[model samples]
Target: MLLLLLLPSALLLVPWAGAGRIIGGWEAQPHSRPYMAHLLIRNASHKFECGGFLIRPDAVLSAAHCVTGKKAVNTTVILGAHNLKKKEPSWQVFHVGHWVIHPNYSKDKKENDIMLLKLKPRAKLTKEVSYISLPRHNEQVKPNTTCKVAGWGWTSTTGDETSVLMEVDLKVLSEKVCENRFQKKYLHQSMICAGDEEGKKSTSRGDSGGPLVCNGKAHGVVSYGPKYCVFPKIFTRVSYFEPWIHEELRKFVLQDLPDSPSSD
Candidate 1:
């Protein structure tokens, strides 16, 4: 039963030939539902349809590549959200006061592909919009462990957008099996693999920067998908980056505002 829950989506390796084409002036279909969500920081404009988790009242964790190649000053992080197509009464938009990408991040290999964003103003905590706890360094989740992945990415290749926060059960995969499957071409120590190896209901496009959570804690950040978008996908391991995260958080707290309280 645990293994079955980790199944990947059948569309992993399938190609969307027209994925590059834009329809209705929208880069891609708007995620079906949008609420306090992360925005994809592109060169032109930002879109609030990706996954993210509030790590602090004023901080959010997401994929580094999401904001790469874009100006940090112009970036924005939309939170307290619920619907994407239309504005909700609780939706709030905050400017990205600053951003910190892992210094060792590699676009070619997509290593250490995590990033942290500091929002202009702190968010108000609530049940609908809240922060996810960070996993302790050295904490390990055994293989076949059931977890949950949430995102606002595309639902299907030809299907319409997905809800603001769609969650699916998943399981962790052993490093050995993961390496053998991807030939180590994408998997790295800083990343963990999850989903059904057989490809049944996996994460896909626009899901990048989302969270792979377990026991109410954030264990990984969505990074890459199967080249074909078929099998289990890889996520940046949050545990391995604990030191860097703390350092960045400390720097942000000191420089941004001393009065800012720590989430921990």
Candidate 2:
């Protein structure tokens, strides 16, 4: 009976294209990644997860597909959390006040897949909560550059979901290589390709929208990957959209600040 039941679960390991999660990675040190944000999004029928990072007290960066058809009322952003199952005192929860998806984002083409979330109430800066820096305008990452991505979700296609966050290091690949693999129609210049050449490490289902941190800065956003999660994954290049990000943040990131207590 056990074998019978387990057979169905085993079939889930089969390859299929979908959102990705961290694979071949270990648990991240609690609260070490202070800017990490875990998003819980709901559609009409069910809830799903995505990853994001804080860019400002009131602004977060994620993939457009994570919220393409979702409503603000059904979305929740959780920051300062290392373990999603625990009631960590450092956790900060917020509702999305607004969403700013790239105007050219296309779900089918998977081009320009980026989005920003404006927190309803600005996140309070603390030891476990803060923001990360973005790359300079048009600053591009070279092929073979090493970067790290983190998120909380399935450890493998057939494994149980991880309660704590996880991360893995991936090496960027050349544009020519990516274009060859995904083709020009799918792999736009605005995207990045990264993963282990041997297919040992990758991002599998549930890790979409996470940050790809390189040199202490976020350079990419997790977008999609292969069905088996064995090949290189594609990320929305952060540097390519720096100008648009700045313009959006400038509009309302500082609005309605709470007054500080007056000192006599």
lDDT top scorer? 2
Q: Each candidate's lDDT (Cα)?
A: 0.64, 0.80
lDDT against true structure, model 1: 0.64
lDDT score for candidate 2 against the true structure: 0.80
Candidate 2 collision pairs: 20-204, 20-205, 20-206, 20-207, 21-204, 21-205
Error of 2 at 69 (Å): 2.7
lDDT of 1 by residue, 111-221 (tens): 788988887677776555677788888577778988776565465655456444556667888886666555644455578887765555666666677788877778888
Number of colliding residue pairs in each model:
25, 6
> Which segments of candidate 1 are over 4 A away from where they belong?
1-36, 45-49, 70-73, 186-188, 258-264
Error of 1 at 16 (Å): 12
Superposition error at 217 for model 1 (Å):
0.7
In the range 177-258, model 2's lDDT, one tens digit per residue, is: 6665666444555888888877667787777888999989999998876554456678998998999999988766445445
The per-prediction CA RMSD against the true structure, in angstroms, equals 7.1, 7.5
